[model samples]
Target: MAQSYATDLLHLIQGPPGTGKTLMLAHLAQLLAQDGLRVFVTALTHRAIHNALNKIPQVDANLPVCKIGEERLTGDLNVPNFETFDQSHFAEKSGGDVVGATPFALQSQRLANVEFDVVLFDEVSQITLPLAIMGMLAGSKYIFIGDENQLPPVTTFSETEAAQTSIFAYLAGRGQETMLNITYRLNDVLTDWPSRTFYKGELKASDEAASRRLNLSPEATRWDFVLDPDSPAVFLDLCHTNTTVRSRIEAEVVSELVLSLLMRDVAPQEIGVVVPYRAQSRLIRSLLRRILMDDEVNKKLVVDTVERMQGQEREVILVSFATASQKFAAQMADFLFQPQRLNVAVTRPRSKLILVGSHHMLKADEIVPEHKETMDMLRDLDRQLPDHHPAQRGYQRVKATRKQIANYYRLLISIMLK
Candidate 1:
């Protein structure tokens, strides 16, 4: 479909998490450039622009690709910047066949007179209509690629106005977009719920990815219940409560998990900790710094919010939902249980995903009426578990006690082994 290009055509590709949208964009850009059409690529952020262009060389090594922006903006990607070319060269229409930039960078004087045969926009769901129009003016044909279920454009406008102004939200389910059906990052076990709840069960895992497991050795057996290689998705039920944004108990548990992974010889770079609140993230990082004490190791592990984890993957991802108080959770229900935020946080792991939180808090019946739909969706995950699963029984037995949680973990390991 990408090979057959025409003028004034607008195509949308809806790619869910881990579905390789950036790779498809790279191939499309290379193919158009080979056919003598100037291709321009832009996204909402510099990291996204770099991610799309970095894959072009893998498709075809000789394609002349140029990235627009300063060196500080584009990280570690080996692509030529617009500043390398003289103003007269671009004015003569003799610049690189493919150029990449953000919508803001597309407005620079250097590319003011430049135009392209095709313009591809990545992460369009996070882009508003006005920003999209800025890039649309630079080309005659267009291809928009993103997942509306991941993250919507951050805006101060009302939800109604935001939806009307978002191109992806407006045109997503109206039968105009092509859906990528296969994900290579998540195993089948980890892919099940999000696929059913968000993608209408259209997404499936590749055979190799479906069978993939964490390659932990016997030395890691201490954490086998939480990091079970056989089970790709594990939820540690820490039935504790936190009335505020920061939970010291959750931070301590996260640090212990990181230390355990490191002791088992997992590369620090292969582990990531994603939290919903910045205060929680800061608390976890501080605990890790004091425990690990090595600046190099500390820098290698990524500890950040869900927004920063988009377009990046790790072998193992630990999600910390720090608020377990019913009142506090209800107050922030819209942000905490937003489908897009939950989806992005869970789908970031390539091998294992560990979700640590109080299921009871999220399962409360008194949640705000507007967020009840999302709360029910989470409840469905618990309902689907086998009657004998630890998450089902542990919630009642642990009673917010650490010792009981540890006892519950031992029982879970026995069942898993049998």
Candidate 2:
């Protein structure tokens, strides 16, 4: 159970990987519904908001959910009072009702004009400031939830010193109060090392701190782990398997080993092997088929990318990252170390993470290099955003601005970065 705290009308809830931010929002809505308060739950993506609002039906079967917009969505899963901005011309169908949309979508004369009691923003860091502010304007009480440590906004200004954790900190300074020291994503055993590495600078490291940050029991255990039956474990893993295109002998051996694992009873969904590049995903898929044909092992196995597995979990996950290009490897290295994104991939597994396929690819020089040029670039762009962002900046502009910048600078940042 969560220890309750006092929150102002405007609430900002932030926790690490495993803290139940989504569930908290749902329960809060349920409580308000009990009081006969009409609650408007919203967020950056209409699809994501639909996921949240649809939870209403399971609780209250009669609650109507209507999707209005370009997505051409409507029906039972749609929140009756909800609307998506970028979807088909369902705005006419809305008939004066407020709907969910990206910040830029809501900036129009129509969507932004609606009113409501509570507006919620999830994955708040992914969007930009202008939209956050605009969304805040659409509702009386705005609730923003995010995990800054997992992934900062992918923007040119991302290297800005404030990009990592102060996302909600900025809002708190601007009258958007925060719900501090709560987490839903990670448990103790899993978050301990990262907590010591990532957050130890400002605060002392302990299970309490880890629990609060990760939102799990101190005794909680993690399932994902990378091991070479013949080698030591790698902590920050971007494991990949190759089926055809291979230059090095080690890469070949790794591919063979991955094939060997699939021959076992592990269901295709039980193990997720992700290679960031399309060439890699394709090569592995093709090779997997060929290997099954030639080998005596049972031919049951599966492979896919991280984006395809969002909001889904497995029993085991083996993520493969190829770093043939030194620069590409460096980018992959950053993706692996990024606490926010790292959380997303690792937490997808309920049992174990067998990170195979990258000892030669992501050598020290191949990953997050300490180059003066890049650091200088990061420091320069860091100042573009407000230290104290506007309280109501919607996720659209903030996230969009970040994406635009990230793409300009980190063109090679793809797969997981995308």
Candidate 3:
């Protein structure tokens, strides 16, 4: 589909995470340029623009790519070529076969005279309808590449405002939409549940990906509890009240898990710690620092929220589902459980995904039938998974003493105060 030059006019590429969408964008632009067509590429942010251009080999010889923006804004890239919309040289350099910029940059008056035969929008799901239409004005045809199932554009306007839809979502029904089905980043065991739960079982793990092994040696199994064949994803059901979404016991467990991985020779760079809330991320970071103490280990591991781990991947991912409880299940069910957020969180791991949360909290009876897909997946996984918990139970639950609870509370307060 990347090399196809069909007459459909508008092309939609539904590239899920780990499908190499950025690489395809660069190669498609090269194909269009070689066909003697003027091509232009733009994304929602400068970092995305840099990411696409960085993937093109011998960028200067293969494509007449020019970065369009202010020198200060695009200076960090250190590209061989650049053009500013406000500069005098823009008129001459802008006529190149391909130009890269943001939607706002393309709105410049200097580009009013320029036109493109094809314009490619990367991450089109994040581009608002107005901004997407603004880009189409300068191009006769276009290609949109993104995952509408992921995050959408941040729009201040309501849905009542003239048909609320992102460019990618709007064209999904009207144009040719292609979904990339094979993922190269996740292992076979890691891909099955997510594919059936989130993507309607259309996604499959590539043969090469299924055969891929972790960087750790075979002896590392002693510390890697997730290596069990029956259960690649472990759910630790900890008991907690809904009063605080943050969990001290969760932090303690995650910290211990990270330390074990470190001791087992798993490089810190290969592990990622993700929490549902910012407070949990902060708390876990503090606990990890206290557990590791070494500056090098601290530099390698990542602790963040699900929102921040959108396009990132790690060999092993540990998720903290903060604020899970049965008493407040009805009140907090809708607020805490989001299908897309859960999809993003679980799919970030290549080999293993360990989720730590309250099973009762996650499987709250208050959750509407429609919104229980993620929790259902977890429940199904838990049932099929053999009892691999070290404690001889199917899952582990945190049992904190009165003093330990007090210390955990104080630690949270101290971190907040700092």
TM-scores for every candidate against the unseen true structure = 0.88, 0.60, 0.79
Tens digits of per-residue lDDT for model 3 on 100-124? 7787776775464677889889878
> What is the lDDT, from 0 to 100, of the residue 177 in candidate 3?
78
Q: Identify the candidate with maximal lDDT.
A: 1
Score candidate 1 by lDDT.
0.78
Candidate 1's residue-wise lDDT over 1-418, tens digit each?
A: 4422443578789888889998999888877887788888998888788888889998888888878667666566777776533432543554347888777766776566677889999998888888989999998888899988887788876444555567788667666568998999987777777899999898999898877778875684445567657656667777777545888777877777887788787899999999999999999999788778799999999999999899889999999889888888888776787778888998999888888787656754485677688888877654445343343221111123566447545644454455
Q: What does candidate 2's lDDT look like per residue over 1-418, in tens digits?
A: 1222234456666644445566666666655555444445555555556666665556655433344444354432455433443233443442222234455545664354545556667766555675567667766666777655544555654444436333454664465444334333333333333344344422222444232211112221112112222111123322332322232322233344454344444445454555444566666666555544543332334455554444445545555554534455455444433445544555554434444443334343524555334333222322222222233110110111333334423422232254
TM-score of model 2 vs. true structure: 0.60
Candidate 2, which ten residues in sequence have the lowest lDDT sum?
A: 391-400
Among all windows of 10 consecutive residues in model 1, the one with the lowest summed lDDT is: 391-400
Model 2 spans > 4 angstroms off: 1-6, 58-62, 72-99, 108-112, 161-169, 172-189, 199-264, 286-312, 324-339, 365-418
Cα error, residue 213 of model 3, in Å, equals 4.1
Q: Give me the candidate number with maximum TM-score.
A: 1
Give me the overall lDDT of model 3: 0.69
